[model samples]
Target: MKVIRAAVDEMWSVMGQMTSAVFRHGLPMTDKIAARTALTNFVLHIHPVRVRRSWIRMSYTLCLGGLSFFLFIVLTVTGLYLMFYYVPSTQHAYQDMRDLQFVVTFGGLIRNMHRWAAHAMVITVWLHMARVFLTGAYKKPREFNWGIGTLLLLITLLLSFTGYLLPWDQLSIWAVTVGTNMAKYAPIAGPYTRYLMLGGTAVGDATLLRFYVMHVVGLPLVGFLLMVVHFWRVRKDGFSGGL
Candidate 1:
């Protein structure tokens, strides 16, 4: 009997430990408990534990930055859906676009959503930056954060531009060629820079793969890291509203 009781006690302790690890504070009902729960959560902790009601009002923030982030999420989900049908080779890319348009179920909608959401994100991020500047939120300690936000904006544009070439049509080809030609005016390393961008002297298979890789992997990784830092800084710097 003694041994059985000891085993039961040990079992209960083990279960309790597992439960606490999973649930953190077991759940919170009151304001104080809710605050503690937020404090312990990684996602929730990104937002402050408290906020002034006036500071968070919709009129003050307009939520442009949040909407921009929401658009990015939409783009990512839709982009992933489109990727299974896309091939980055010049020979197959146009055919792949047609397959996405007519062959795959819901592919047209997904592709359109990705394209539109990308456009919306560009506008939204621009407005978000404008709001920050108009509010004088970029002064002093926030200046570095502002620079990071600027980099994120540029990344957003580059991601959109790189994606534009993946359709591999005459229009896309001409557009990228014209866009890259501007690099040739940069002096000494200009031609080399264009070569690096095109992966050759002209936009062809190498350029397609380069843009696809940057669109799907490189740019997104860098943009995501900067976005993480931007959000962290926003939380650290505190909202400038109600000032």
Candidate 2:
């Protein structure tokens, strides 16, 4: 036990020496001989010298972006769990969905949670945007963040649209069909876009598969990547004030 303690102390000493060398040029530690007492100590390195907890709490209340991010995390987790029991094929898809509701344990609850969370994420993001806009937080240095937020709003809408067809129900089928048909209104590329989306002229097995893949994999992944950038940029730009 004594030898082990000696080795641990030696390791801490080496770490202390390394940290001291790194910060030596910037500022010298004057108070303590022990590494633990040194400001250069690794364990103490991240401790803030000064902090205003009230300011932080107020900042969070003013900035709803963090709440939006939390909702997105909830959606992602519940969505992945729902995907485990859901199949993308048209023929058995509806039956499998029914099985999820009636046969599988907690399947209905999981699907409900995912569905509700997706909706809540959309609402929270919009609220965050509204909060930013109302407070004039989008002005000046935040214009770029505003632009990213706009794109995220569009992505959120796309995510909802893509996920609409997953249940393979009449409402999902017709809703997606109508939505995709609007794509046909786009000049020369419209018809091709519609064709690619439906995988043919009409919604069927191929359409179901495409939407499922997009909802469960493609759009969510894109949203997640953009969300990371969006949050990082928010921190970089600093928190905007509330009106």
The alpha-carbon lDDT assigned to residue 106 of candidate 1 equals: 97
For all predicted structures, in order, the TM-scores are 0.88, 0.75
Q: Tens-digit lDDT track for model 1 on 134-184?
A: 988899779989999999999999999999999898889999999999999
lDDT (0-100) at residue 34 of candidate 2?
Answer: 36
Supply the TM-score for candidate 2: 0.75
lDDT of 2 by residue, 91-113 (tens): 78898889989988898998888
| CA shift of 196, model 1, Å | 0.3
lDDT scores of the candidates, listed in order: 0.91, 0.79
lDDT of 1: 0.91
Give the TM-score (vs. native) of candidate 1.
0.88
Which number leads on TM-score? 1
